[model samples]
Target chain A: MSVDARIARGGVLVLWAIFFGVLWETGASARYLGSRTQWIVPFGTVVLALAALVYAYGYLRARRGGPALTLREASGLFALLVPLAAVLLVPHAALGSFAASRKGNGLHFLSAGQSAPSKPSDASFLDIRMAEGDTAFAAQAGIKPGLRVHLLGFVSGSSDVPRGTVEIARFYIACCVADAQPVGVPVDAGRTFAKDTWLDVTGSLERRGRRFVVKGERIVAAKEPSQPYLSFRT
Target chain B: MERAGVAAPTVPSFLRLRRAWETGVVSETVFGRLLGGFVLLVVVASALRLGHGPAAQTFLLVFTSIVIEALPFILVGALASAAIAVFLPERALDSLARLPLALQIPGAALSGVAFPVCECGSVPVARRLIARGVHPGAGIAFMLSSPVLNPIVLASTWVAYGGHARGAEMVAGRASLGLVAACAAGLAIGRRTRASDLLRARPGERAEAHDHEQGDRATAFSTHLVSDFLFMGKFIVLGAGLSALVQASVPESALSTLGGAPVMSSLALMLVAFVLSLCSEADAFIAASFTSFSSGAQLAFLVFGPIADLKLSVLYGATFRRWFLLRLLAVTVPLIVIGTLIFEAVT
Candidate 1:
């Protein structure tokens, strides 16, 4: 390729590096890769930037009167640039109830080694997946017939559970959205709420047969959290 | 040539190289056609108003996720490929190639442990090895095995399944199956194939084709790094798009019924591995979550995924001829199937 062409191509590469690096720095990468893999953005962006710089230097000495890249090669480079549009033009987003519904069977987000959330009253961290932490915290106060706790999650599930209940759900992810699975708890608040509505519910846990049902003392609307997926180490 | 900090392509030779490139290269309007198709797609999507919710949301989610996840690994691979071009001596590569095919293939496969890269990162390195006169089969072996045998991947596999009943056994199975399949494929290809038959001449490669043969390490390295990044990066975009489409549309749970039988579950998980295209480092966690599948089937997912995935197939297209990839799949798929079944019988 000509010097001008090479320089132009190198410039494009630098722009891509900047776009992704900015995405990572601004935390947009978390939407695509799980929060744990954010480290890749920083490390990867730097490598790309360095390669671009080297490419840019070559363009200076390259004479202006040179043959252009074959059409095939130019197109290949252009296709590489397509992701830039995907990043900048297409909207930035995080996976949510829409994704959950597509997953068929709801995801089980708990880590293989993670014990079911311990009781919150024990002053230990509860699993954030599926509102396990809140339920565990409430259970510690009592995993009895009438144990009350505060809970927050996006509403999920269908008619099977019971009336006056919502499935408080969250995706638990170890790596990326591709591996994300839905995990949720059955909450019986005695009032119906729209599906996928983010809610803060003050509820009590009751043990009925093998199921631990949360009956709500209060329920109100809430906003989706900044980071939607509850992350686990892969 | 007097080298000073790896000078860029000079004027006259660049022209000469461009002319050489035109000579057997088929001319076509591929990129322009692709652009037309894309514009048409946007128009159709807009007309249908399909950009509104879940379906569009899911498509973008999966598409961008694959792009984001795989891009960095490709960068790492390009850098390693550059290093090989700049620093790895041709003599060293030649000596390794001099060994018996059996020894060379397995040795290359075993050496993957120290490489620490996933499948995306390994492809360019393998291509570079082939360009440097290493046997095509050995290069292919390294490409296939490094992602599976790399220490981090192995550790992740162990950790993902460590809590299960046959955790250690699963890890061992993945490692052994990976090695056998890779080496076996390598030898099969090496026994009679020629470079012209296996490798394709990608556009923009001609510039480095000169510096590569000469010992002009600096320029050669930089040229290759740029060439590889651009070539591999485009295919990555294509592969990621294909993978995302599968992820957005397909409900994996639908296949849960296929989980009941031994060979069926193996084939089923193999299909999952192809589409999901999870990084080898993280696939184990997903495989482990398949509590319903037999341990052997889970092993099949872990073994087959790193070698052949929707993403890797696109990359193989970029780096090799079409038939080579088809042959590769033919050999690899059956080996994983039989290997996993044997583990099922024994364990």
Candidate 2:
């Protein structure tokens, strides 16, 4: 092969390895990779490797019987590959950062009037000391237990025992919508609404022995809030 | 002659010392392409990384789960295309071409149920089928339906919607409508054009010549695989980077602009689909994220994305021609719009 062709072929191989290697590494830490690191590391490595390989391959091939790749040709190939490779790598990097930032944060609170009820006030504060099984009310353990706090969520399901009582639910998303977990707050509204109906209620944090429950009055039906689901807030 | 201290040219030194640095090394094309890629990378990376609080994190996680897991699978698809070029029996494809369109359409749609693979995986398979002599229309139809109707996508959509009635309604509605649209487009284009017109394959004799020269099937397969990897490596990187940039640059609020108006929403969602080019397996979750939009609009997002999108456009451009892609986009966009409308009316 001509030096140019040989260099191009070698450049292609090195570029392939670098791109795949970065992809593999990014894939491995995709769930936890920081956004900056994800984009820069994977794509940067691929670009640098490609440049070096093309240059070296061209020179070596020219020295041997192989065809030489001109600087123009090498650079042209790099230009094409770099952006294309970047396109692929960027998402992984962006997602990695997104995942990290979203780790424990609940879903975007879509309530018009009330902020998502959090113990620490700021949604960014993740309660690491809190036990996994603990409910939101459980976080209020030592505080005056019966303090009335406004709560809002969607009705997940209803209970038949208390005439027309229902359980209102919301999901907290830690990252994407998939990892959302439905969290319920029991409501004793006199009438029943359909499942998945959005509602707002004035409720007091109640402890039925060790169990935490929301005992509320006047559950009112409302329009579906944007992002009605609850996501995890880390 | 025997001069004292005369040194011979050593092969290793000669190899090492060869002046490789030529002037005018970087051309405008190379510089431009690399710079464009770098800019895109930086923009996307910053968008993903610099955001504060929960929203940023949610975006990141969603991006990762949906986009990252999809890369290897796509690479496999590209690699598979290369492999088919290397080793698969070309004659077997003739049987597929001879099958009636009636059998072919449904058969292609149902084929998705057999595999959990996503749209990216389908690309290579479709290409291989085309190379093997399947009608371009049939192969295209299979590509469209395979991702949406696949078992994994169905199951995921079902899980997201929370049961049989809703899930069935969503899947059946989207699947049937998408199938009709894709098949219609394929048939329309297929009638006027020959399969050879779509993608110019190497002459059969040349392929056969390469096949004979190789010592054995294994060696040929390996060679083809390596070349295939090299051929597709750049595109994979490009596709991934473009997806990231779209994810980062476009805000979720941008979706809200199209809310309530089904037509506008459909168009906007289609644009998003084009830009995001998300893997079909996980597009459901992203679609669900567009909670503000109606089911019809969400359905359009899912249907349009798998069939035609930026990444797919690039891939198609790489394989086919600009004229073909432009024609494809013209057909596919209207079909998706009509499908979305039908879904809205029925559901």
Candidate 3:
């Protein structure tokens, strides 16, 4: 498939522009791409339009018997498109598994004084605290016991806690995933839960040596929150 | 003659043995050579009384992650070059070259802001531009600046350093210095080297060859891209594995000790950057990890890396002639050092 060099180039530019526009609109905030506020979308759109103009030029030139798309030409276009498609797929795959896996493991721990509605009798609460030497929670002791505290975090991979008892775990991100640290407090809730479950728990925090155990609370498993991760205070 | 023929007929086993060695099917030499280095490493590790199990596990993890991640990206770069070879217009670059020198350098640099191509991808493209009549100086400038000046790099830097005043200041300082250095080197190279002296077009081409040369270049570009990708892929993996291994094997105390000495700390971080060959987008995170290093030293790491690191040097050497690359390094390295010194002086 022999394409006019001009046409192939134009097509590539157009495709790239559309991809960049979509990325920008969707809040893809990479430095080279655009900011999170969708400013790049219009810029990308303009590039795409210009590319269309160039493609039109190539098309007109070709119509005068300029050039035909050869097998090699088509393959090259396909090769370029395949990567573009794969790039598009990355966010979907990342969000799907990452969001689901981090569902309920208390990924976010609200500081002390955050209010929570009353909990149902059957469920128990766990007050999660950073381990000693961890600077993430040093400034604020999150959610004290006996106070109605609301917690949002994901369920981490399960761990066996002291014979026949299992505890759900979640990692809190103070920044990017590189700085993520796991926090696990014992949950006396009767049922075992799957890993990465996003949940909201209402309970009282019990302090246990840098960790807060939430006792007697309500657990509500739900969709992962928009902000799946958190950053450490600068 | 009859006696000699009879004797040879009875030696089938010997013939088989000879054939096996010739084909490397049964050569103990080859097997021994393959395992010799690994065995030596094991022996050394055992003698050191280190925890071999954890060390081995860490090495394996690092090796796989580095190699696997780098392979696809290098391939992407190679393919992009091939596409450029096959499809880009012949006179397109000439028209670009007609622009003023001042405009050309920044134009080339800004071109990358939109493309989002990594450092590996820039080498062949730069080569192609030079081949197509873009000034060698401008081409080199683009190659150096594109990796760091692009939107993705800027955004990542902002993201990584946004929270702190020091981080923000560092990014701004590096950007200012890096751009100035790239432009200065480019203009210097542009003025010094004749275009014909710097690059050789594809073989079987005339001084003013047109159609046939284009066709040959297209094929050569594809070949170059594929071969370059495969070759660099191995090294990228090796570098990454070595970095991961070092991270796992050497304790942080080693870095801390070096960190205590100002000059030693700067050189050590620079060495780390060279060894890691990390993508510019990711280097900031690694730099930040060295919380022990002073800001001036960290600035050196960021500046020296994008210009003269291992993988990029290899790419530059491969794409441009060794003489040209050496000259480029001579100019770039000292400039970076001066930039670093100036940055330190000011901040």
Candidate 4:
């Protein structure tokens, strides 16, 4: 490739570096990578920057004449550039009701008959999900029928949810959002809420048939948490 | 002097710059303009459309997350590849080549126990190894097994299943099957083909092939690094988009329909594993979530997923010959089925 084309490719690399740098600077990488942001974002930025520098130095020393840039080369660069640009330009987002419907809730683990960690009343959604599955965890946390708990989540309209109730859901992300599993319990709020509306529900856990439902006492409007998804670690 | 007067012709600076771009001297300006226009267009379009629904919202979230998570590993793979290209001595290559195929393939497959990188980070390193004169079978084995056998992945698998009564069996089944698939595919696919036959040449690579070899070590290292990064990175991004689309549009119930039949369940979960394109380290938790499926089927999900997924398929396409995935599936699918079956029968 020509020196100029090579340099152009380098510019594309710099664009990616800038994206990572921005993610790191704004602490937005945690939203994507969860606990991994501490290392991956900064290290990725450095590798990309160094790679770009290598191209820049090559351009400075290069002679003007070489093969013209090929269509394949241009397409490769754009293929990398366009989607990331689209992501960068779009307003930040999180997994919501649509994702909850498609992915299903994390209740399947309840049937696995496994042990789980004990958590406090203010535990994350993942902890709550796991607690519901493990009898030992529930006992240790003093969780039982008619015990009131505070739950923070968005309203979901998944079809599996019973009528007259909305699934108050948060995603349990393992690694990243791609592996996010919606974990929720049905909240019988006596009224319908718009899907993906963030809500804080103070409710009592009640067993109905084989499943658990939360009987809502106080439901208040809430904002999405700064870290919207609940991760495996705190 | 008056009679001989002639006007001097001059070109405007913009026209001069355009001409320079046309001839490739200032071609970088064109790229800069293309990037700027594309970004502006996307920003405007997203502002209008991103708020319309959750599907687009989910797509953006999953797409960016996958890319962000995978990039660091891709960079690490590129760095390792560059090191192999620039610093791995001729003696090491020769020694690896001299090993017997019977020993080389299994040895390479087992070496994954030490490598902590997942699937995203193994492809380029394998490509570099093949290019640097390692046996094709060995290189393929290393690439295929590294993600599955890596300590982090194994530890995650153990953690995901450890609380259950059959946790040991699941872990053993996954590790055993993963090793079998890797070694089997390596021997089968890499049997008669040389590197020239198996590896796809990157665009512009053929023209400057010798130039890369002959350039200063630093130049060569960086060139290889950038080339591998960009080449593999774009395909990964595209694959992530497709995987995200599948994730958003396809309901989990669609696959759950086939969850009861033992054989069909394994196949369905394998298909799910392919579409999901999850990182190996985290895939076990997802796999363990399918409590209704047989343990064997879940093992297939674990083994087949890390070896081949939508994202890795795209990466493989860029790195290997067109038929490599086909060959890979032919060898691995049967092995996985047989392995899972045996695991079920025994356990």
Candidate 5:
């Protein structure tokens, strides 16, 4: 209703534009948005920045006109600060083992590798199929029980499996963290690792009841992948 | 009607100020008091080291992610809405309203195919449409349809279910059922209500269209755009916070106890969709991940989510009256359920 109020609200929009720009430039969007970082972050930044400039131009056109912003309006504008505060105050981390506890560690998540090589030589390929429980594909790939497989994933302390085993899990994010689902396999590594520890696990694949279990023969520390979350696009 | 030469009765200063405050014209002192109280609460909360935990971390991530994900769409909607308000000819709007109701509702529902915005963007546009004298039912139909019938959403649905045995069926069912639900809900909501009764009044907002001068079109557009974005953006932020809390705290299994039964599974997934408040374009992948649920249940999720969700509920609250959500669900739920069941029976 007032030029000052418009400028104040526009300043908030500018702050958001800055936030999004920082998110895109610093690559922080990947931790929260995953694959969506490529488009959403830049687009949001541009839209917000242009909107802010438009708002500022109007305020400049009528610099001294109208009443001040009302308390309710001011409060509503201030409420936008919540997300900014949350983003700043909360420590940022990738969704990991703790998140899996709620989202579950299941292989039901769809994977990009719907069709793979028969008798695949790559251990990761076998590992993914085993995780997906694609017995037909596994059979085609000659991946039977006791076949040696090397898989890369972070350890998750999933209670779905037996006490002696921890789940080795990877998240497949379709959009953002809200839609992320974990695909994991129960593995017996002899020694326990911290939750979310990246590990290169070379193990013999075994079937126990409905789920696959990995008998780890060689376990080594592995760095988290540059693109930690998996997506069909990549 | 005052008597000639009679002086109007003057009120006491304190009484006038009290009346002003009660009528929503808050004084600087009242505003400062509120600001001070909020600052004190924040300081106390910070001193307590609140929001420090795995759950809080998860909540923060989800909350901010949802905000970041949804804001761009809301901004787009605001810009589109402002354009409609400032640029679209009044005669064009009148022509839209002049159409027969039967044709208008269906036509508006199908128009979503041309407008690719999702639910977040649709809300502001719908509000502007109603304000600009479009048939309220048609505006409502347009709002409900754009998110689901849009090409991007259908393409995503097709791709998400591409690996499934009934991918085509899912896409077809989603499109058809979504259109049906949108029209039904629109007809029901706009049946007896006026636009003023349906939409919330924005405080300090300029009068809708009468004040616009020919030269001030750009200024008016900027005003509407900024106002709509800020208003809608705050609610989305608050809504995202609520959704994040539910997503972080509630175990998925807690709601899935009835995931086995056909009717109950549909209801359960609908509840999940509400709680998750995911974007329509992205929700199909999440629905596809529910391999344990039936196809009908997944369909329920895909259909129910874009129409109503935690985020949309908050936005709706800010936009419409209390009865809006109830009226919406009363019309939409049964249609979606019956549709899904038929989908299940057919396939």
Candidate 6:
């Protein structure tokens, strides 16, 4: 490849760093990195930008005359950019049923020091999904039994649909999309919604046997959130 | 070849302009046009196709995540490799290499504390270390241990598994197992191997070694860093794509029951490690999420991954003889299996 082409490749990498940095800065990176790891994208942007500058400078100043690029070399460079461009071009998306199912996403076990509750309180499906375990999920996370539950998620693949229940589920990530685990609220919507449709459900968390289920007041179609996964910490 | 005497068919004006731009002094002009057009086409096509299905969407999201996560670490690795190339004192390196293999192997593995480079970085440095006259054993051990034993990887493991009852145990298991495998592999594979036999110079490096020798230090460092980053980044992108494909297509149900079988579970996770090629710094989190698997299985994933994977195999192959991988794997896999079982029994 030409010296200019080599330098341009460096510039392209720098741009990618900037592209992902903007995503992280603007909250788009939450779809992939969890709360704890989101910092990497921005840092990568800075480091890569600097590296690109150094590279461009060094290559420009070097006095070596190299041979012309072979077809294989040019093609190899193009191949590296294919997936990168594909990822950045498409709008950001959340982990869906297919990804969730692939990771075997499910309710996580409780961490230490989070105790079981003897009584339910005011909470929503979001609270339960983020909670430590089934016990913590059942106890209203400050939510009373018949309050508005604002919930947003796509229908999960493993969610059992019946005459009146809607399982609005979202994946919870610990690091990145690969480890995203599905956490859903089984909502009694009193009607049926097709799977994989993003929805905004206004419901109330209610105790049912050993689980906390949502009894919906109203369910409306909603757009996919800019950041879809619930991070482990937040 | 076309008859030289035959006048080349009169090329179209536009085609001539394109060819001229491609070979012209300002070659970047053609590259910019082609890149911009390609990006536009891809953007439009991906946007149209992204929402087509959950599977496609899932694949994209996972693929992007893997790419974003691995790129930075690889860049860091490149930088570290550059430091070794540009800044490491030849005499110091020689002194270290002169130590007996018994001390050199473990010492190299332990030196990861001083340089926290990741696996991507480790391969290039290992190749350099061997090429620069370090004992092949020491270089191999350093390569094996640096990615796993480094504080970055260890800390990530602590964070990932910290909440579990066996978190500390798992971390310990991963470190000890990794160190053992690395040192053992170093001694086992590189003990008497010729340095020339242990490494193959990179095509660019072999060609440019004479030029770089005359080049200024700053230019050399920057050049090495950039070239190493670009070179390693190629395999990373491909590896990330392959890993995402595996994550999207593999059925989770298949491994659900295998977690109970310690032997099978360890092997299953080893396979996952080989395929995913997840960076060491981030892999602990993924391994931690495998809740059904025993600690032993998880430990195996952590231990085996940084040392060997599809990407590392390809990356290592570029710098070493073809036998390097088979040799590394032969000694490393059994140790991981046995280590996992021991860890299971102890924990």
Model number with the top TM-score: 4
Off by over 4 Å in 1: A1-4, A61-67, A104-111, A115-150, A158-164, B1-52, B163-165, B211-216
| DockQ score for model 5 | 0.45
Native-to-model Cα distance after best TM-score fit, residue B155 in candidate 4, in Å: 0.8
Worst 10 residues of 4 chain B by lDDT: B19-28
Q: All models: lDDT?
A: 0.73, 0.54, 0.51, 0.79, 0.80, 0.72
True lDDT of residue B76, candidate 1: 82
| Superposed Cα deviation of residue B227, candidate 5 (Å) | 0.6
- Residue A96 in model 1: shift from native, Å? 2.5
- Report the C-alpha lDDT of model 4 over A154-198, residue by residue, as the tens digit: 987766656667888888766788878888778889998998899
What would the per-residue lDDT of candidate 2 be over residues A1-234, giving only the tens digit for each residue? 223334454555565456547554645433333222244345435544544454454344332243244553454346445433433543332222232222212211211011233553222111211222345423543223465656666665534223345666544442233233344545566667776566778765544443234466656777655334333321
Candidate 3 per-residue lDDT, tens place, B1-347, comes to: 55544344565888766644333231334334534654465456556643334344334433333332333345555556555555667677668878988898877766666656557656666766676678888887887777777777666555555435665677786677668767877887766676667664332222113322544543344334433443344345445545655545554335434654556666676766665565666566456546557766777677666776665655554455667657766776666666766777877
- The candidate maximizing DockQ is 5
> What is the C-alpha lDDT profile of model 6 across B117-235, one tens digit per residue?
67877777777777777899989999999898888788778777654556677677888999999899999999999899878655457534554688577678777787677777777
Q: Show where candidate 4 strays beyond 4 Å.
A: A1-3, A36-38, A54-68, A108-120, A131-133, A161-163, B1-33, B50-52, B163-165, B206-212
Q: Write the per-residue lDDT of candidate 3 for residues A126-170, one digit (tens) a residue.
A: 223332223443234433345455556555544424333334444
For B126-240, candidate 4 gives per-residue lDDT tens digits of 9989998988999999999999999888877777775455766777888889998999999999968899999987665653454456655666666678777888899899889
- Which CAPRI category fits model 3? incorrect
TM-score of model 4 (CA atoms): 0.90
TM-score of each: 0.85, 0.58, 0.51, 0.90, 0.88, 0.85
Model 6 interface RMSD, one decimal: 4.7
| Alpha-carbon runs more than 4 Å astray in model 2 | A1-28, A31-234, B1-68, B200-215
Question: What C-alpha RMSD separates each model from the true structure?
Answer: 8.5, 14.5, 13.3, 7.2, 4.6, 6.1
For candidate 1, write residues B1-347 as lDDT tens digits. Answer: 97669777567977877676554232235435655776676667656655456666677777777777777788789988888877887789889979988788999999999898789999998988887788888998999899999988888787777546566787789999999999988988756877667888876666666665665555566677877877788888888889878877777777555666788899899888898888898898888877788888889999999988998899998788888778887898888889998998899
Distance from true location, Cα of A118 in model 2, Å: 19
Winner by lDDT: 5
Q: Rank the candidates by lDDT, best first.
A: 5, 4, 1, 6, 2, 3
